[model samples]
Target: MNSLSAPQPVPLAQAHRLLNHGPTVLVSSAHGKRRNIMAASWSMPLDFDPPKVAVVLDKATLTRELVDASGEFVLAVPCRAIAEQTLAAGSLSGRDGDKFAALEFETFPASRVAAPLPAGCIAWLECRVIDEPQVQHTYDLFLGEVLAAWADPAEFSDGRWHFSAEGRRSIHYVAGGQFFSTGEAFEVSVTG
Candidate 1:
């Protein structure tokens, strides 16, 4: 797939740019014999070096329970095509059973964590928990360190992303099944 965005080296420091626009992400985790997947839009980068991330997971969510017990989770950035599945993940509860199986979802292996990366996702970030236990227990917020990250070569390479089609572009959750594509790029030059 050809992309209009110029390809450049993806520096370790710039990895955060991948999620900077704040697209909704799937949080995957396992505890004992159970595993779960859920959607979250309230996630952001906290630091550059040793890459850190913060995400809000409701305490009542099955995802929070599993992540708290396991101390690890995978963040998968889905594309427009999987938007409905993403919404369903958030609406349903993993307490029932393997949510992925119930949803007929597919997954791929991650290099760092046990949590399987969701299929059809544009990008994947394997994360391990870090500081702010107080926040997690208090606000249902979890902090993590990005251990590994991989992107679909079709949509992303080097340090930049190139969305070739509507279905391939990253999706941003609004509400319910509603979402907005990352949209076209525009830049402004700063004169000092």
Candidate 2:
């Protein structure tokens, strides 16, 4: 599959914009010869300046193992164009085989982490896992410090999303196979 557009760097201070609207993301990770990707809807930005994010990875998932071992992961925001593949990535188990090859997914190496950045995503966030074994084992929650961020120029630029093109918008998963495409744009002015 071809990328909708090339990814451009997003400032660390503005990295939260990519996830502010709450889109489902694919968490990709790798350690040595092991690599895996899984779709997650339970991810959110936890901080601003030193940008941090939190995501839930089930204990049984291969992604959890990879992230724990490597201390790194890449969060890729998949658009509507590759929604099916995104779901498939989450459903299959990497323990059986290489999910990327099995699902025909393509990826590129990230700059600051060993995790591979999945292709066809509108934005990518390379993260270094922040040690919090208590929450990790108890709640299946993992926190990461945003090391690098990138966005597809066509969908996001200047730290703002401009999804003017069809099938280029981000997606939010509901349940089962249902998902909602991010639609429309609006702004509210605050008067003091």
Candidate 3:
């Protein structure tokens, strides 16, 4: 799929909605000639309006090294269609070889970051790291300011998600190779 046409721009203020549901994300990073992709379930929106996000990256991972050197990364929300690849990404180490090619994944360049956004994802967030050395060193946490965000028009638009098709819905990772696809949507009124 063509990444440019597949994803429509999501306003900075509404970008957090893309990650608010807390699905597993593929964090992509590149510094100099080395580039890598990894699956991460410990990622979430930390703020809105000049949106910010936090994700846990182990200190020893190549992703951590790249993000530390480049100060940028792309968080792509993968759907059920790529579940196997997603699992493999997190399972293998980029130190072994190019994970993307090894997993037979495709990608396109991101607008605001050097890391390429993996194709077939439901949404993408290009971010620049917000330095916090203490927390970074102690907790292996990285915080970023969202520079750009995009979503698949078929699954998301107007700050909402419509997962009507099979294998097209966002997924949440459990342990091992298991995952749960986002289910039905509903609403309730609360009068304050």
Instruction: Name model 1 segments beyond 4 Å from true.
Output: 1-11
lDDT of 1 by residue, 1-192 (tens): 112232233455766877887889999997787789999999988889988888998988888888888888988777788888889998898888788998878876677788888887777778899867888888888999988877776677766777777887888888757899889867799999
The model with the greatest TM-score is 2
By lDDT rank, best first, the candidates go 3, 2, 1
lDDT of 3 at 50: 79
The lDDT of each candidate is 0.81, 0.92, 0.92
Predicted structure 3, TM vs. truth:
0.96
**Residue by residue across 1-192, what tens digits does model 2's lDDT show?**
357777889999999898999999999999999899899999999999899999999999999999999999999999898999988988888899989889888888899999999999999999999999999999999999999999999899887999967688899999999999999988999999
Candidate 3 residue-wise lDDT, 65-94, digit = tens: 999999999999998989999999999999
RMSD of 2: 1.0
Pairs that clash in candidate 2 = none
TM-score of each: 0.90, 0.97, 0.96
At residue 111, what lDDT does model 1 achieve? 76
Give candidate 3 regions above 4 Å deviation.
2-5
The number of residue pairs in model 3 that clash at the backbone is 0
Ranking by TM-score: 2, 3, 1
lDDT of 3 at 106: 91
Shift of residue 130 alpha carbon in model 3, Å? 0.3
